[model samples]
Target: MFFIYSFTADTPPNICITGPYKTWRAVIPADTHSLSPVLYCSGCEDHVSVSADQPNSQMETDEPQSFFAAFCQLLFKSVRYICIYIIEFFTGPKQSLKGNHSDNKVNLVLLGMSGTGKSASGNTILGRRQFVSRTSSVPVTTECQVEETEINGTCVCVIDTPDIFDDEIESSVKNQHVTKCKQLLQSGPCVFLLVIQVSRFTDLERDILRKLEKAFGSKAKEQTVILFTRGEDLQCADMNLEDFLQDCNSDLKNIVDQCGRRCVVFENKTSHKHQVTKLMQKVDEMLNKQQNQ
Candidate 1:
């Protein structure tokens, strides 16, 4: 036996199924919208009328109509849902001007103590003088600043923050800076570039990870990467970063381990684009790992 179920208005009947048992076919007119083609093998004498509403309601059947009736009900529901999905897809509510996908930016924030090359690293990442970076004995960045550019088709927003947690900076000013940093990153995903001088990790920075966790919750380490500035130090040592870190002190190793061993090196004085590409790749890998979790 065979059966056909036609859905379209002008097209020929669509062959639905074939079986060895005798079958019955219900032909619905194109103009009629009440009941579409519904086929039942044994029970064809009585019409199975289905309302446009309540398509999944129990059908009148003496035999087991679970398969056939459920199929018909599912077909009706699928058509209705597909129509709704299409309508909503085209005429759905508009995204907020601020919440648009183009605004799905990623913030790469430079965070560390004073004189750790945070500002210079920001300039290196942006590939321009977005922040003031000069030979200054004092910290140049006094307030939180941000600059944006596109990288790998993603809007990369780099935020330069002052040495807020430094003892020289006032507590009230640090509080305000922290608030502003949160505001800048509230709209999108953010990763912390814990910038530090290659050979100049101070005791103050030993507790820097603790401070970050206290301020941004314990997950801060998960989103952080140890950015060793002044790659020349490693070059002068005649060693690559991985070898240097392996022989590095326990404190530095602890910091790296806390951040899931995520680390990258940068030479702010150089114009090497490959370094930026590699760093961005590490950032993407970190983000992907977080998402999978």
Candidate 2:
């Protein structure tokens, strides 16, 4: 007997097998848009019509491999490749007139106070775990660290910095971080990702941006993107991103306006696959607009 399920959906269907777990086949490609699972009992064998709008949930496997299992694996692998290609068209770099991947490379600097998930957003964009996060009462990132990664063959450099505006630091230490930022931007044109917690907005963020204004001039906002971390704060309720931002306090609006009205929300805890794609798409859209102008 076999049961097929998908892990990439919402409203995921879960069927209780009073007995034991069995191998399953996913009728549709596993993805974020998948709906809950629909179990096909071994005896029933009704060909369920999977809806494209329906999303599946993460599936759990408990049995050993079989010939059919191998075949199913190959099928899904092909589907994954296809999906990545199509999604890359939107979320990844754009193709050039010469049919080559476009090259309007930009360095992105992440700025925010401690515990704002700056590094986490960088890891999500780079498609790997490239930075660390801390939940301590005190700040952890002591120096600026730079890492280079690629998405759809476009090279990107992500610089993660310590809390430049941490209260514990003196002017000398603050300038050290400022120097590091210049070095990171040495490669070429760059953008900034201003991260802030979703639950609360603070004046400290604005004060830091004031310093950034001095460094990059008023143009920094044009190159900046506001990334709100810990999106799980809105997970339970049904809310749009704009509504979430509108509900923010005065301090948040000041920061948002400084970033040229560009913003992306992120959940650093769980891997909600599509969020990264959506974020990068917005990032590319901003860059593309700037290039055209």
Candidate 3:
């Protein structure tokens, strides 16, 4: 005869079965997060009494020793699979987590439409004019550029990409930009800074996020931070960044939510080192949370 049962760790395994046939009970460890139903069967062997405390005691069976070894192997394989599932549940997305930790550096990729102050934001973060930022009728940065600096005791490498999301741009040209961006990603943990102008959320800006997802896959936003430039707009209205976000349109809110609500504001015109410092703090927080998971 055979019997099967399941119980949580907190429950006392006080099961006692008696019959003319031999009886075997399998008790799962308490530390396991989940309980899988286990079956035990009596075999042609002498009857031996077992107590609840002695869960690991071997049950006499006329079956070959190899049969027991095979059963143990299958049980361990199931436990290992469960462990991997639990780990993936806690760690949300992996796009931002891939990198060699030995080379401690963070890659900050600046991406957005033309005239969105991406270059200026890069300059502000680096505390110097590393990229050409100027008022122009056309996209100032026609290619991807990179620069490095030390921020808050961490090495930061910023990549400035052109307005590759423009529909008018040829697909071949956009492919080239994408290729260059991938080549520039040979640093440590990376995060994309999706820059946009404050108080000027255009229709194109609304759709640019969708395009970003198409180009970088659905997990793109997991490693992305929505950076709103021209912070003076908020200051002039006596509103903080959160306050502004609370009143913004749903499109922007959805974008922020997709990125795990990781957003920051930067007044590129000002030289306030504190602003850069605050943004870096958000970046570090994201890194820490991802690493812990």
Candidate 4:
């Protein structure tokens, strides 16, 4: 006599049957071996059976298989990232994935009254005539313009603006010019070049610093550098920058003092590269000091 039964254990139970000319054997299916189902003889009255509450062995193994698959996937991702980093180290990235180098540039904003040589000074700093600069009864730079150049490996952005401090210019127009200048400031430290002609401080320029503060906030003075244009005027007068500043009007001296006494004399008519170099050195020093603070 034989009977079929299914067990959930890993191994089949051993059964012993003793009767007159009767014996029983156990068998397991090949296809359902993982389930560990067992067959027993019907004559075996005493034997262990699987309970309904017991879980199958096949179901238990599924969790391990899932975990192994997840582990393999994680290992593959790790290898891929390593390969990418190695490739980049060897061949370098095709482009800047984060941002461009222009974000690290320093902006040099030219601010002064009309006929103060702002446009000419901008051209001198850039070492090119990017702005229309010429002697005229009216403002030569009627709008704001931007140009870029490199000074001693440092990227420099020069911004030339119209005479926003002019009394004749409408307040709305002045505000618009100021707004445009602020927009072009972009992302970087800004240094304002308060251009003033040598020995030419007029009534219009007396309160120029106050107007600058009104346009760009009071902190503007902290980063301002008084740029005296037409160094030839000082040379013709047989005086150096120090002498000129010493004899300058009280209001002009006060403005320079308010700007931390940062000043540079530029002979825009001459091709003296050292002048630009010296100015850039001062700018670097200012930037370094700002960083330290």
Best by lDDT: 1
What is the C-alpha local distance difference test score of each model?
Answer: 0.73, 0.64, 0.71, 0.71
- Candidates by TM-score, descending order: 1, 4, 3, 2
Candidate 1 structure quality by residue, lDDT tens digits, 22-116? 35444432333343445445444633443445745775556555565555556554455444444344445655322333344688988998888
Give candidate 3 regions above 4 Å deviation: 1-103
lDDT per residue for candidate 3 within 104-166, as digits (tens), equals: 588999999899999999999988998999999988898899999876456889999998788
Tens digits of per-residue lDDT for model 4 on 1-293?
23233333343323233234434333322222232323233564422222112333222221233433233233323333333344344444343211232234789999998898999999999998889999898778878989999775667899999998889889999999999999988577899999999868898888998899999998888888889999999999899999999999999999989988899999999879998878876776677677668
Which runs of model 2 end up more than 4 angstroms from their true locations?
1-104
lDDT of 1 at 166: 76
Candidate 1 Cα misplacement greater than 4 A, ranges: 1-104
Worst 10 residues of 3 by lDDT: 45-54
Which structure among the candidates has the greatest TM-score?
A: 1
- What value does the lDDT take at residue 229 in candidate 4? 93
What value does the lDDT take at residue 68 in candidate 3?
Answer: 41
| Model 1 quality (TM-score) | 0.66
lDDT comparing candidate 3 with the true structure: 0.71
TM-score against truth, every candidate: 0.66, 0.61, 0.64, 0.65
> In model 1, what is the error at residue 268, expressed in angstroms?
0.7
- Which residue pairs come into collision in candidate 3? none
What TM-score does model 3 achieve against the real structure? 0.64
